[model samples]
Target: MDFLERIKARKSCLKACETTVTTVSGHSYMEKILADGTSVISWPQASTSPGYVIDTKPDLQVAHVLPGLCMGSQDVAHDFGLLKNHSVTHILSLGVKPVTLDQMLNYTYVQLLDLPETNLISSLDQCFIFIDNARQSGGCVFVHCNAGISRSASVVIAYLMRKESMNYQQALMHLKNIRPVIKPNPGFVQQLKDYEKMIFTLDGK
Candidate 1:
């Protein structure tokens, strides 16, 4: 199916979204502003796990895309305490900015110059290596761009496709299932489909 068709089919999966944050008390918390301009807070984490699942509207600041993985904006990248709280062992910067938190702690840092219009297939292999290494070490990797919707999300969806043996549709569906607001650009979406075809051809599928 084409990108637009896929989007139309999956639109219903995204609704009633909010930004999720975990409190020091080990509860999932989110603050929302209603249409009437009233602030409402909710704590839904009656339990916790090694990796907390965040289900809410896509906030560029941070969204837990999957277990052992997250995608966020540059604001999240600069927040040392947030990274530490989430036990993020690696940071993948998918923008031109030099990662400032790399030397602040012992975290592994990988930077790639990926623009919204840039084709990402060439960098997938290298990026995959860093992400895989972090996961194997029982650590999580946070991928981010200026905005989490396009560049960073594209890199992450590519990783899931290549590493997890999922096709573009499946990987994207899974991503949106977790983080509802991810919408990669059309060019990136096409590149992912191309990458999917390449993987299938290599596997003789």
Candidate 2:
């Protein structure tokens, strides 16, 4: 099926599923429970579009993944004061756009969908370049998506695996240690596994 067809099918599936409001850590969000017992978290407001699942409460927490790398939700990305405080000189927006463009910070926007089937591997090379450029320039990069739970998390995990010479599990565990809330979709997890294999192959390891 084509992309649009797949999106239509997903929307139909979501519409047919049972959704409930659930609270965790004092934050409320919609959870769509599928027939297979898989639950997908969604935004508080009604929207089935990809990248729309944001926390109801403003998430200002930014986890410092590395010396010059940080991960956060769009809320923190949009907050000028928070970004300034973090000394963020570059912003990597995944699957979401900033409210306004800030001239002071370098921006790299990647068009990604918060879906299992979304192809993040193809975009990783460019993302790595953008991130490394900021770090090499004595600047920090803030990576974020709608909620910093899926797309952005996957990118950071892939970055760690490649840059730090770690395996998928090692990268994930290290990231989870710093940001426990990150949970990449199943497809992204598999892709990261595939990426690990590819990396080893290219290195002849």
Candidate 3:
């Protein structure tokens, strides 16, 4: 199946699945049983309420997309030590719950879902302002989502395309060179292409 077909299949599968919330040792976990009898378990970060489980560790990996701009997973954003080490003073959180860290750091939270149908372009202007403000103030900005794969990667690519005057393909290629795991969903890719045209029109190029 092609990309759109795959997306449709996945969406149908998701719609057909049954989901349940269960608490284990105060941590809430979401369990989904697909139509095909495949079970999937996920830790719902927002279910933890005021804060998340600090003990649940994820691999500490961050990729520098630009001089002062970096991209990583939600875990890297929550890690105080990692933020300090990277000198990340601003955070652009996409589709993930905000973690309370320090008063010195700034955060811009966008309620984005990591679904292909989600409109990522509408959030780009706000995100770009946050990133630009951080860069102007000589502070580093770390952009992240759940897995640092789709949502966050698309944001970074959009930033590069807008600020650097690079096309979608060029920006995507540059980011892929730095972070090979970067892969924006098909819907996001189409939106980015639309954004490029919008930019060109505004620039009279």
The clash count of every prediction, one per candidate, is 2, 0, 0
Listed in order, each prediction's TM-score against the native is: 0.64, 0.73, 0.71
lDDT of 3 by residue, 1-205 (tens): 8998887787666544555564554556678777664688887664544333464568479899888899988989989999999999999999897797998999989999878899998898899999999999999999999989899999999999999999999999999998888899989999999999999999999
lDDT of each: 0.73, 0.88, 0.87
Candidate 1 residues 1-94, lDDT tens each? 9998787666645544467766555667787755443467887755454345455443435677667788777677778788888878788777
With candidate 3 superimposed using the best TM-score fit, by how many Å does residue 89's alpha carbon deviate from the native?
A: 0.5
lDDT of 2 by residue, 1-205 (tens): 9999887777666533655654443344777676544678776654344433454789899999999999989999889999999999999999898765479899999999988899989999999999999999999999999988999999999999899889999999998998888999999999999999999898888
Error of 3 at 18 (Å): 28
Query: How close to the true structure is residue 91 of candidate 1, measured as C-alpha lDDT?
Result: 83
Those runs of model 1 whose alpha carbons end farther than 4 Å from true positions after fitting are: 1-61, 102-117
Itemize residue pairs with steric clashes in candidate 2.
Answer: none
lDDT of 3: 0.87
Backbone clash pairs in model 3 (N, Cα, C under 3 Å; residues 3+ apart or in different chains), count: 0
Overlapping backbone residue pairs in candidate 1 total 2
Displacement of residue 78 (Cα, Å) in model 1 is 1.1
Error of 2 at 54 (Å): 9.2
RMSD of 3: 12.1
